[model samples]
Target: MSQNDALHGDDLEKSGEALIEFIKSSNAESVLRGARGKLQEFFDHHIKTKKTTTDILNDLVHAEEGIGQKLVNLEGKKSQMMQEIEEIEQELQRNLSRSQILDSELEFLQKELERLRDAEQEIQTMQQEVDQDTTEVIPSAIYVAQLYCNVTKIKLELDTEPHILRGVYYGGDVAVPINMDTSTRSPCEVSDELWSLVNTEW
Candidate 1:
């Protein structure tokens, strides 16, 4: 209020009469409780279609509290989500490593198969040459005996061989000792007649 608005005494009679007349015409209420707000056009302010801070439910404060709880929940789950992502990354890396190893193994196997096919073709060609020329043979009696022993072993393991060793074909089953060396049998162990026959045939 201005100095004249709070005129007190008959000493300022004219100012006091003017203030009193203004208060009577205004009919303003006395402020007995808390503080009073500044005068303004209050109707123009709240006449619009919008809620203020003092709305019925205090909705702004409630919404703030709700958002705070949601933020706390999100923060709590962040580490768990990060751990799950790491686990997925590790699994993907492990599978990729295994796939690379499998691809390498398959590549090596294909190359080895091609090499084995070439070796087989070379062996067949050499065998045909040896069959055509008997003079080209390397004659070793010990080698012949070892070859015979190996043939016998292969026939035994085949299980469907109608012909095994020469004399042990359809008769008694020959049981070989497990620990003995089958290739160690010398050509001298054979009878003289069989040795002569082998020398002539071979």
Candidate 2:
């Protein structure tokens, strides 16, 4: 009806024709098919990558568990070794104490042995002196007995009685026994050489 309205209707008709032509072209169809192919490729790659990451994470978890178990075993071994070392140290200390005790006992035993040897030597020396005194007394008593027999015209007999030297003077129907004390007080005091000769003759 109006000229302006007629012109607007013609412009709208041209715009709709241009849009229909652009949608029906080969380039638009090719673009749509390429976009669809790219979307499929992206989804496939995402699925593959997710599977790979999950497998890797599972492997890492298993490795960590193995490492933890090894650490626990090592800790147990360390505790065992420490206990053995402590026991060894205690045994060593006990052995050292026993060695010290043994050394002290050995020292005491050596001292006792030395004392016993010294006492034995002292006893031997005293016994030798006593034997020499007894030998001298016997000869002196016999000499006194002989001198008495010569003066009194009796018989003199010399012998050992009860581990001592005895001189028996035999007179007429009488027998008198003379000991060491009687010889020392007798008038005839014989010399050492004469006593030695008497011992040699006997």
Candidate 3:
């Protein structure tokens, strides 16, 4: 209950009468001054609250601008990173293509080398066969002379098996074997007279 509500009967009447008397005796200037002071306090409190609100709004605006700038920078970086990733991917593709081409070239080279090796082996085998045949059938000196006469078109005389000569002749009725060293001589070491005789006969 209020204090006014607690008062009753003569107490309420006396309080009412005293309040009326106080109101009548109060100075007009003092009453106006008191109201002005209260109004000033209320306006001061309102202005202070409005200034705090304006400061908070300014701070919020600055924070928003900072966040926007940061977002723009991050976006730029993201774009750059994306472009780099694309470049790297393109480079990887090119390298893979080059590697594939190199692999194909290597495969072709390896096949060519194998074919050449096979051809070389065939040639060696044929050469060995020819050598074996030549070893088995030795040519006679008369056959060799006939061959030189046919190929070189020169009437060359040669001895049997061992001492084959180009131009020298040993006149005998019967076959007499002469014991001499049968080593082969280079054409460069042969006498010029022999070569001249062969050319003249030809």
Candidate 4:
């Protein structure tokens, strides 16, 4: 109730008039003392058993304050986690970029290795062909040299058997016996077989 509102209304007036009449009809002092006793007892009962609105409201406010503190702590933790997540994402991106560069380099190296392998195979094939050509050409060249030496009447002995040279020059090739031996030339490195074929003792 506001302070401006009247405390007593029409009911209070009638009740007062009746009470005054009763007091005059009976012992007024005794009635007044009994009413005071009843009021005091009622106040004492209310103070002991019932909680006030103010006290309940204060309890609720304390609980709310505790909850608010917990919320603040959680928010701080969440902020730290978010910052850590951002750093991890940045690091992941850098690793992805580095991985991409390594993948490209690996691919290039693989191609270079394949090319080198193919070149090695080609070189082996050329070497085999050169070896085949040398085998077929050597004996024919010796035969030609024998024909030339025989026609010029040059007597060239060799470390090999005489019959072998005779067969190479005369076996269905020339009508007469022939001989030839190639010696090492100056400023040139020659094979051991060629050098040994020259009969130096003869």
For each of the candidates, the C-alpha root-mean-square deviation to the true structure, in angstroms, is 15.7, 22.4, 22.5, 23.0
Rank list by TM-score: 3, 2, 4, 1
- Return the TM-score for each candidate structure: 0.36, 0.48, 0.49, 0.40
Per-residue alpha-carbon lDDT of model 2 for 77-165, expressed as tens digits?
A: 99999999999999999999999999998997798678657656765665576667765555656655554444344443444544333
Query: Which window of 10 residues has the lowest lDDT sum in candidate 1?
Result: 193-202
TM-score of 1: 0.36
Give the whole-model CA lDDT for all candidates, comma-separated.
0.55, 0.67, 0.66, 0.62
lDDT of 3 by residue, 85-125 (tens): 99999999999999999999899878867866765676566
Instruction: Name the weakest run of 10 consecutive residues (lDDT summed) in model 4.
Output: 164-173
Off by over 4 Å in 3: 1-24, 129-202
**Clashes by residue pair, model 4:** none
Clashes of each: 0, 0, 0, 0
lDDT of 1 by residue, 58-109 (tens): 7877888899999999987997899999999999999999999999989987
Once model 3 is optimally superposed onto the true structure by TM-score, how far is the C-alpha of residue 38 displaced, in angstroms?
2.3
Model 4 whole-model lDDT (C-alpha atoms): 0.62
Give the candidates in order of lDDT, highest first: 2, 3, 4, 1
